[model samples]
Target: MDKSNHVEINGDRFVHRLKELTDAEKQCLESQNMRIIPKLKAAKLEKDAKRHWDIFYKRNETKFFRDRHWTTREFQELINFDPDERIFYLELGCGVGNMIFPLVEEGFSNFYFYACDFSPRAVEFVKRNKLYDDNRMKAFCADLTTDDLFDSVTENSVDLASLIFVLSAIDPTHWSHVATVAYKALKPGGMLLFRDYGRYDMAQLRFKAGHKISDNFYMRQDGTRSYYFTEEELLKLFMETGFEIIMNTYVQRRTVNFKEGIDVPRIFVQGKYRKPLEGKSISTCEG
Candidate 1:
């Protein structure tokens, strides 16, 4: 006899189990885990990293993601722009103007946008978009993790920098360097807004043991890698890089999968960190 999937001890509709796992299920789960060839993993990760991203852009082009329509709505910091005042904005790992186009459409006219992506094709997509304007939005292609971003953008420049779902794509060790660039690139008192995968997120939990690149890093079959972060970890990263925290919060949403009789929880870490206005001068780093 099969047991019930839900319990009603308190007259509440609650799910007791995700599903029953058989021995076959366990075997299949194990098979789905990531398998790294220990000796070649590092080399493979290095060589294929850029290529995989290139291929991803080539495959999906501009259709991969929807414009982030909720940006201004979700975070009110982006609003209250004055038409006469000029606000310089920089976006790292900007993908197809998802954040840019939306903010522009919302009439943040005073803000000039500088968007860069490692993938040339992705940059091209941004430049070619219907919403793109040379006078307002500039698109460039460069590897931010190892590139001198100042060459493309001005030094001590932008009033705001955004890293939306971008950091997870990078190697964890390189984040300090990433922060350095954003720090030096921003005007004193400028803010960096961040959002990325959070620790124990469903996406992280779904990965099998073999796919675990490190404690919280993993690679997908598509050759893309992601790192899930804890609130503490993220705080430390930005704090060490000379940013003062404004707001750090985790957002959780539960989506019910009626077909599978399961509830999938998605967790994301969002933050606003600012550089001190009256402090030391920003240091420059070479690529």
Candidate 2:
């Protein structure tokens, strides 16, 4: 048996239970025709996403998402960690330590944090933070699609992973690869927490005419890419790759623009999935 196949789950020998899906379920997944958007075709979209970040950070920098303290609340609620339960946590696309800083301040210091982002500027922002230290938190600059996270973490060792508002930024076609990589890195029974723009989000609708890069995916004027996902699509993607969802909810957030005197309605999909124990298949009841 491959050493990587054996994972430690809550201090126990974790094993893989890759169950065969029912024919009906397999057909349902196949009918959806999910695919990776090729990089060559997605080049413009990627460029657009990068441009959006450049402008966004230039103007707002650390103040952007940091002001929205609700993220910390959401993360705490999702993980529900005990005070003394030490765990290994990884934040994929962790920009500027906004989430990490708050997690530390809340006295949740029973874990190691590995944070990575594709942008050097973003990593630099995290590194410069006075609150960040090398002992408890390690920040790296790498693209999740191609970079190796195991260089910073042991294989099959992470307990929880967070992909908050990150996946939608990448080309939808690459998401499966990301999922596979994440699955390989996490321990059996480990959890994956995600929150991202759902299909028809206010931001997606805000795209100007000709901003349609692909179906249900768009490019912001600032060079950032986004994909709005449906609940069915999200469920099938993860479950197909071997995860059992614990919670999946579509949250509607209405942002009142006091400055513009308009209301912006946004929809976000949030989910928590757990890796199944060895020889035990996960139930797809929620899907």
Candidate 3:
């Protein structure tokens, strides 16, 4: 077995709380910002973000991402419902069916999944999967930043929306639009589950000078971009978008390679927010 790829969440080497960066790590981050990507290059990357992701899938296919077996563990909401209750679940960036197919195999027959991705190649991969059933899942390609998710998903009809590792890949300028789209597609009381990279994670610290694209955002070696978020800013973004925060916090995990004797910290921001019921009145004073 390959212990080299082992990743343990809240593992023995790391605490679950927010990680304070060491002086060296802080200095490395400062150095990363010294030579940012040129304006012309940054603009072109933003304009052709979809193309890069399409190429990513064209090369890696479904093999790049492992099936997400941790969804139920992290989000008990998936199993909290009655076995017979129909869940109109939407996965905002369902990459190659990595997150949805596992649920299907787990016998979530009641969830009718609507999965979308920015890359057409990724969506096609989802559709071609052996577990994909027309009755259980509907996979398509849509740029959540600009394309209307409601074109395929009915407005105010979704029961749950998961944006796992999705928002970070988008430019900060369009984040609000994506949030608004998710809110519109969800029922008034529907929940949105989000998990994304957090500030000063190992990956962010490793980037060398010249990749920075605005504050806390950078381009990866493959041309795909990622933005690290602070929990406060992320929560504020959703709250301002009309979601009432249920929970928001940073999660620290460790990736360990015993064979190679390596252990590194990973930081992520996880949140759950709910859309307030329409026309619900608030009382000024408590009883």
lDDT by residue (59-118, candidate 3, tens digit) is 898888778888887778888999889899999999898888999999998999999999
Q: Give the alpha carbon lDDT tens digit for every residue of 1-287 in model 1.
A: 01454333222222322333467645645554546435368558756887888889899888888788867755566775566889999999998888899888878888899999988888888988898999988898767687568788877888899999999988887899898888888988888888888766677667765665665678777778898877678778888898887766555556577999988766677788888787655432210
Badly placed stretches (over 4 Å) of model 1 are: 1-39, 254-263, 280-287
| Candidate 3: pairs in clash | none
Candidate 2 error regions (>4 Å): 1-59, 71-79, 257-262, 285-287
Per-residue lDDT, model 1, residue 233, is 80
Question: How good is model 2 by TM-score?
Answer: 0.78
Tens digits of per-residue lDDT, candidate 2, 87-120, equal 8888888987877787777666787888988776
Q: Top model by lDDT, which number? A: 3
Order the candidates by lDDT, highest first — what do you get? Answer: 3, 1, 2
* TM match of model 1 to true structure: 0.81
In candidate 2, what residue range of length 10 has the lowest lDDT sum?
Answer: 11-20
Off by over 4 Å in 3: 1-18, 281-287
